[model samples]
Target: MTAPRLLVLQPSQSDPLAKLGEWLEAEGVELHLVPLKEEPAPASLDGYQGVICLGGEMGALDDLEHPWLADARRLLSSAVSQSLPTLAICLGAQLLAVATGGQVRRGPQGPEVGVLLVAKRDAAGMDPLFADLPFTPDVLQFHSDEVHVLPPSAEHLAASPKYPNQAFRVGSSAYGLQFHIETTPEIVLNWAAKDPESAACARPTDFDLDFLAEAHRDFEEVWQPFVARFAKLVRGELSPAGCLGTQLPLV
Candidate 1:
């Protein structure tokens, strides 16, 4: 069978899907990255089976400064409306929220920037993608902005102490993750180097490469299966092993 192709929107040159790409490709999902910051948005979602928008430095509300954000919002809105399997990370999630009539602004609790645990909401047990996650899964939090309100159509999934919008599902197939599961050690190190204050506050002491590596290992262990399941959803295989043994058919 031909591999399923997914359109991956990369909004920033610096932040790309690092290890998450490996899991998807390993499962035979073809990734076609679109640099929205550098190029125009595609006319439609015609050829792709799914969409993935990665994290970036830009805010979702920065349409004036970054005009492509408007285009990204349109594409994401289309995906959610059409029920195309979609996953939006960080700023991408913020864009999806803003596109869907949800609200996004500076997180009042401040920037979440370390390995943290987010509790799965009871509603997550009913979600196809989130059902199998651990009760308190370790997730990387590194965003300054947060979603304040969700579209009425959105299903709340997970939450951290400070950020309640850690994970959510809009429609049946589209998802938004507030934290970073696709980051690699080098990526985290780069972010830490660039913004020393946030990173320092996130950790007990100074940044440690070895500890970051360990954290990445835990991240892979916890979230790679999540990505694998997402890839299966993109491929139209709702019943396969991933984080969840078999996805329940959506009603």
Candidate 2:
């Protein structure tokens, strides 16, 4: 059987796939990364079985400053409409929201940072990607903006105290995560150093090497298998029958 090929759109150089890539590759999924800043964004999803849009430092609405954002949004809209297996993280999540008739804005509750937990909504219990997750899963939050309103077609999945739209799904296979599951300690530290204001919003202990290290361990325990399952869904090893009776082809 051919390994499932996923197109990973990296909106920022700092936010590479990191541990998420390791986990997905371990599950036998092949990743092809496209750094939108350096290369042209693909106009179509012709050859890939899955798409993953990573976080970025820019706001989702800043299309004028970052022209690639417009292209990225178009691709996300296409992916969701086609029922392609897709995952959007952080800024990517906000982009997904806006691209699909949702809303995103500078978070009114301020930047949500640090290692935190998000509670799953009732609908998450039936979601293909979120169903198996713990009631409250560990995730890393570092964004200044939030997806305030989900798209018309989205099903709410998870929420934190400050952000109501932590995770959501559109169509049958596309998911948008408001938190970071692809970060490492080094990546967090780099984000902290670059954006001190957002870093200051976090608890003082959040930056401690020991504390961050332990948090990452907890994150791995919960999210590694979640990513593996996503890979399986992309490869057609699993079915999403519970999520509106949709089933992917077994490749």
Candidate 3:
């Protein structure tokens, strides 16, 4: 059988969707990454089994700065409308919420950084996407804005101490995660090197190479299992056994 085709909507070249790509490649999944900045209008979602939106520095409301955001939102809307299995991370999650009638706004204080814990609010009786995860799972995070509310029809999945609206599901197949589950040590280091501001915001006092290395190590351990879980969900698997077993039916 042919591997599932995943459509990756990327915002920029510098911040490539690293961890998601890594997970997909390891799972033997086929991916077609369409840089929205370059190609604003996506062709169709018919051939693809899932869509993965990567994190970006741009806000969901900043269409003037990054025009592609509008198009990306439209694509996400279409995907959700079709009930395609979709996953959004970080900025991508904010975009999904915005596109689905939810609101996205800046936090009252400032951006959230470093490794944090996300608790499953009411995911116990829900679908198997979050089946085996601990009630509260520690995950890496770096974002300024948050999803204030979920779409009327959406299901709240997880929350963090810092942000209550950490995750939600638009439909049975679509999910949005506020934390950066798709980040790897290499990717985080690359991002920190290119964007000094994010790095500074992350570690205000001691923003240096050594600090970044240490931070990367701390985050990697927290990020790995979440990435593995997300990969299982993408493959329509429920638990570790399901992930280890042959891939499940697409639906």
Candidate 4:
């Protein structure tokens, strides 16, 4: 049999999708990293077993600024129509929300950054995408906007203190998480140092390279198995043990 194809929609120079590509490559899956910013076409998503949408600096509402946004939304809508397995992170999640008739707007108060706890919503137990995660997981977050409302057919999965719609599942297989489960220490530091202005605005004074490195180490162990479980779900191997409860730190 052929390898399971995973299509990644990448739109930023940051290349955060590389982290997920590395993980999926190790699992012997066929990976395709497509930069939608350059070539935005709905046909690009064809023949992929699963789709992952990576975060970018762009806002979902700014379709005029980024013409690719419209194409990406069309692709996501088609993916939903087919019930294809999909995982969206950060800005990608916002895009998914907007494409599926949800609202993506600036937070009522401010941005949510650093590591924060996300409480699983009522339908989380039945969500195959969230398999192996705790009802309350301390996940990495960095976003100024969030999904305020979900589509009529979507099921809420997880929420953070700052953002109630942190995670949602649409049409069973398509998942969107506002936090960054694909982040590593290197990736976080690279973006932080490169974007000094945004960093200054979102990061607290105590949020230094050292802090990010330490958090990366602590979260990596928890995130690895989580990704593994998600990959398994994409491959259609959903078992009972795969239904992950809330993951708290091991003492």
Highest lDDT scorer: 2
Residues 104-142, candidate 3: write the lDDT tens digits.
999765777765577887653455666556776667677
lDDT of 1 by residue, 33-96 (tens): 8898778889899998899999888899898889999889999999987888999999989998
Ordered by TM-score, highest first, the candidates read 2, 1, 4, 3
TM-score of each: 0.92, 0.95, 0.81, 0.87
For residues 1-251, could you state the per-residue lDDT of candidate 2 as single tens digits?
88888889999999999999999999998999999999998879998998999999999989788999998899999998888889999998999889999999999989999999899999899887889999999899998899988898588999999989999998888899999998889899999999999999999999988899999999999999899889888998777535454568999
How much lDDT does each candidate structure score?
0.85, 0.91, 0.74, 0.76
C-alpha lDDT (0 to 100) for residue 22 of candidate 4: 68
Model 2 misses residue 114 by how many Å?
A: 0.5
lDDT of 2: 0.91
Poorly placed runs, candidate 3 (over 4 Å): 193-251
Badly placed stretches (over 4 Å) of model 1 are 239-251
Weakest 10 consecutive residues, lDDT, candidate 4? 238-247
The candidate with the higher TM-score, 3 or 4, is: 4
Q: Compared with the true structure, what per-residue lDDT tens digits does model 4 show for residues 1-251?
A: 67788878887867566556767777767877778777655575668877888898889878788888887777787777776778888988999999999998888867677767799887777665564577677777777888989876788888876779998877757788898877776677676677655456554742566877777666666666767766776677754222334668999
Q: How many backbone clashes does candidate 2 have?
A: 0
Please give the distance, in angstroms, between residue 19's alpha carbon in candidate 4 and its true position after superposition. Answer: 2.4
> Model 4: clashing residue pairs?
132-244, 134-245, 134-246, 134-247, 135-246
What's the distance in Å from true for residue 39, model 3? Answer: 2.5
| Model 3 TM-score (2 dp) | 0.81
Q: After superposition, how far is residue 48 of candidate 4 from its true place, in Å?
A: 1.2
